[model samples]
Target: MRKLVCVAAMLSLGVTQVTFSADLAGAKDHPLVSRFRGADAVGYGQADFGNARLPSGANGKHTDAAGRLTDIVYRAPPGKRAAEVFENYRQALAGAGFAISWQCGPGTRDDGCGGFRFAGDLADPVIATLKGDSSEMIKLLDATNNNVSYLIATLVKNGQTSTVALMVSQDDERPTGVLLRVIDAAPMAQGQVTVDAAAMAKGLAAEGKITLYGLHFATDSATLTPDSKQTLDEMAKALKAAPALKVYIVGHTDNTGALAHNEKLSQDRAAAVVKALTTTYGIAANRLAAKGLASYSPVAANTSEPGKAKNRRVEMVAQ
Candidate 1:
């Protein structure tokens, strides 16, 4: 069950469907630093963190019912120094089998970068432990309204892992270190699970005006799971709510299938999604464009089943 949930999330990441063009090794620093500069600073901690400090937060949103925050955080200074911290964190967590989910805050939503929103759905607790000596799992609690973000790095080791989430607020404004407080108190879910849409798009918006819909899926398969449809429905509401903005439907997949097959699948699925939007949901097709990617690009790994799942996915890029 744990493996299935992990596979589902990896599939949601789009590892099985599309490929990437740019090598994202150095894309983490600037965007994260920028986000740190823009948020409200509640407290400051030592810039140099050799040891992991547990964070705490209220259980209402950023935590589970038991009040534990299950997210992983890595702090670094601005500029190259921060990247070094990121690298160290990457190595440590990767040594344990995790994949970093590269993310950026709202201020840096350029092409190829994941925009900031809530850390709600991105947080996946250990549904079931597999091939590990440790039973402890990592999760990012709710930061729906707290506007700080960074280049999030997730890791998966032997089907058991934690994410190395890196964030930098604009001007280096940091949040209260309440993440650990919640983690210590969170009650475990009963089974291996995938994050849902409410958690994924809690605070997401488009063009600083329209609220964006985040519909994520695994690569290759165009079948919209219940979670994927929920996310799309949320966006559909946003489209209905704000009728002026146009959206581009971007389709992506992992590096597993043949390039031609991947491109076709991405295109067909994207067009299908647009079709659903226009014909079924009443959104205009003119508001959408289908872009297909063959398996040359990736935000995670193509080596493992979980990583490949993360690689295959579709996203709505802003117009």
Candidate 2:
């Protein structure tokens, strides 16, 4: 059988027993993270490249990353406990050079993980996992909301990081089900992820705000690249087309490093845009207000470069 993910090392941990069955049609393992031995995959879904919002730490914190996301719902053979399945994954992940970022099992907390709000926060993942190959095999799929065993682990290899989260359920009416999801950081193909002036004008007219990704800057610096002139020229044209329009030139950044530093950098980037508009593009200074949201307002997650790329953008909000 062609298995996905590298869990062969799990055998050394006394998980040597093996059983085989057909996984759901068009479903398979993650190819980098494996399932518990003899576990039948009841649900499987994959995104070659996309964003994932995984609940982290207590108190509703979340880790939103963009990359290849693979979610698998596996049910172990009879006579297995959810805790055992969760423990097997922990050891296997550790053996595979992964570090546990956060973990919680039943009876290990005060307000319960219910305070973490995984159910409410991660409704998307739940919905995605449930719909792939029918939800009947997985039952309620309530592990996220229930006080179940769960853990998040990360592995950094060759300068890229891969994260995996496991949630195990111990429902009396169902077999032990493991929700395994893995995401690895990858660069999104650079293309026209940005909009042109025509689209920008339409967006502003429709939504009162338009997010722009055309402005270029170096790492941790606010200076615009030479290629940014084209985007600026387009912006200038847009502003000229709407002579009475007043807008807020807001700067945003990805969630990285110290929050205060990003705040200052974002402000500087916004100011740079304003300077170019007034001094070079002939936009009046009074018509534009520059504000910095830093990482506070992100269009995407900051966990991966692609997500961060989307987050680090400027916006024009009608003023």
Candidate 3:
């Protein structure tokens, strides 16, 4: 009888050890974020504070001010479809005071908007890291790789605007995946410290170089924002006041991503600034040379958000 009982106990242990569910071990939702009902977190990461570029509309992006950035990946409960998962989160976000900025899904009215294409790019790293050796799971993710449904939303709470990007996809394996990214936009930086034409002239005369912090550009793009007009105008005025003052318009960036990419991006931005000064502000094009030094001469350490912000600026050096 004792031998029979021992065999039964061993059988019970084998039954209890059966594995199920694909959620990543020890994954959990962030404090400032939440997962959809019946969904389990499969991956997560966060930066204490950073900037996030949120999709504004079709083919458009906007940079949120410095704040905490959080990313979470979730697996939907069995029997749920990707579209349904997206809708559930959309409704939940709306209920939580988030205004939908944009939304798209497979076969939906906005199906061809390229939102899903962007989502696939955003999900690549997360899935690669968390899916591991599960070839079936990888294939499942790739099946809907181009059919992802997504939503971008914003909410203002506690005097801060928070941006959210949510994406969902599913495959024949019956498991849906959702990726959530949130950026808590901090208050806009204080008014830009402007160097007037007089200050620029003095600096050029004495130090042969002047740094300007007022110029602004869209995140990861050469396009100047509207608020950059005043700064460009000042620069043009200084150049016009001294017709013989040839200078180099140097662009600098923070060491955030790939060095090569940053070098190219900075060069493009400097060239754009030169074009704006000449064409829009009526400064002579021959008087300015555009150069990108990348992150070689950072004014501060790149270990913190404020330092990174300071490193991304345009400067003028006498030539």
- Best TM-score goes to which candidate? 2
lDDT of each: 0.39, 0.73, 0.69
Residues 61-138 of candidate 2 have per-residue lDDT tens digits of: 678776877777787778877777777788778877888988877622223463654333443346555445545443
After best superposition, candidate 3 residue 128: deviation in angstroms?
Answer: 6.3
- TM per prediction: 0.36, 0.61, 0.48
lDDT of 3 by residue, 126-228 (tens): 4554533345334444444455677788777667677788777676565887777877765337235778889999998999899888888888998988888
Clashing residue pairs in candidate 2 are 4-31, 5-31, 5-32, 5-33
lDDT of 1 by residue, 74-152 (tens): 2222242333333343344344344444433323212112332333233222212111111112211233334334443
Provide the global lDDT of candidate 2 against the true structure. 0.73
The true-versus-predicted C-alpha distance at residue 71 of model 1, in Å, is 22
Worst 10 residues of 2 by lDDT: 10-19
lDDT of 1 at 98: 41
Q: What TM-score does candidate 1 get on C-alpha atoms?
A: 0.36
Off by over 4 Å in 3: 1-26, 60-65, 107-112, 125-141, 187-308, 311-319
Q: Candidate 1 local accuracy as lDDT?
A: 0.39
Q: What is the lDDT of residue 83 in candidate 2?
A: 70
The RMSD (Cα, Å) of candidate 1 is 19.7
